[model samples]
Target: MVMEDMELERLSAAMDGELDDEKLPRLLGGCRHDPALQESWYAFHVIGETLRDPQLPPVRLHSRIAQALKEEPTVLVPKSSVGSVPLDGATQRRWLAMAAAIAVVVLTTALLRPSLPANPVIAQNGQSTPASTENGVSDRDIQTFVALHRQGSPLSEFQTVDYTPQTIAQR
Candidate 1:
């Protein structure tokens, strides 16, 4: 009796260690009772071993494989075009509605955002003053504040120490 092509394919896959875990036990159980499947399994292993080392004895398999191929039916059906199928009108409308809702939310958020002050307050001599005021902190005061800030910064602890060859020798 001719064995099914699927069984033969599974046997081949089992030999190659590519068979799924769920189907492996079923394939092994089939091999236990089926002599043809057992022979096919042995043949596949011999073929693998021969390929790995040409020095090993080669077994005739071409004729058996050719006979099997001749027995298998040829299928010429076209591949399914499931991916190319167009979306339904309702789906398209739903996607458009979602996009419109997101746009509305973004526009509303932007419109309702708090506006920044035209003339911000400037800290001058520990007192807050309107930047537009004549008595507001000058550029010199800003420079002094920045210098003080840098001096008090935590990273200022890593300040570079001036050294010379003479200083090293003295130490």
Candidate 2:
């Protein structure tokens, strides 16, 4: 694959007078028999001609990007600092507290609901009874939530997962 890439690179570069005498024939020979490569060479020439003329119609960036993405561009954004991705100590403690409280409410409701019979009277106080949580949303969601929070924040060393469908309890 690398040899093929280098051959193509050399052929393209030869057109720009970038390749030396030793490489010219090999590049030419490789490009001559490859119909797809030859078409690429011709298209490159046409693009060059358009660039030199400058009066050619403007290319839509979105179309060009769509085509390039189909061809698989190699660009990738580098990850930032890796440390400090987890919530700070105080914030984690607070989250633990809220989770604990929510769990307590749910447990209390579970215990209290048993005695209320099949048609338990509705509480009209407008306060919600905590329901069973999430059918056990994966640990992965927690990781992603933290990652997304980091992504939205200015924390340079924080960025990772993405997630959905859960909220931290306040009480």
Candidate 3:
């Protein structure tokens, strides 16, 4: 195995024309019997061909290299034969359902934004108004609302219960 590896390395170096001139003839002579060396020599030539042609897909070149080296393929994942697995239909559906649920929640929040109150403010006429009113909310209204909020329970407490004139706490 070690000898084969050494020969393969020497074959690669020779293809690159980097081997000593004295070693090249002996290496070529061994190529006839040593199939591994021949394979390495062929791989180096294929690599050279792949490099020279800019259009060849790199994956094909990689596959060729792996085949020539007789190593487990580093590129091109083999299709699932037995042990290899993919997402089950149920798993895919569950993920899609989750994504759809999230989208629905986001859309609901965005659509409901204009109707929801920014701050709970009991107006002068004893009507509850959102602080984000398009008609424009007065600064005094905001101040009074903030003061009322500071004095009262959290805003959620008033959401289920109706507010009365007494809720305003007159300035």
Could you tell me every candidate's TM-score relative to the true structure? 0.29, 0.29, 0.30
Local distance difference test, each candidate: 0.46, 0.42, 0.46
Clash list (residue pairs), candidate 2: none
Q: Which window of ten consecutive residues has the lowest lDDT sum in model 3?
A: 65-74
Model 1: per-residue lDDT, tens digit, 98-170?
Answer: 4664455444433443232345654444454332121111222343343344445676623633222122223
Q: For candidate 2, lDDT tens digit of each residue in 69-157?
A: 32332233345645536557865565475566445544553454443234432222443222211211122333344544554568632
Deviation in Å, model 3, residue 12 alpha carbon: 1.1
Cα RMSDs, all models:
33.8, 26.2, 32.2
CA lDDT for candidate 3: 0.46
**lDDT, candidate 3, at 166:** 29
Between prediction 1 and prediction 2, the one with superior TM-score is 1
Q: Give the count of colliding residue pairs in each prediction.
A: 0, 0, 0
Clashes of 1: 0
Worst 10 residues of 1 by lDDT: 131-140
Tell me the spans in candidate 1 whose CA falls farther than 4 Å from its real position.
1-3, 53-171
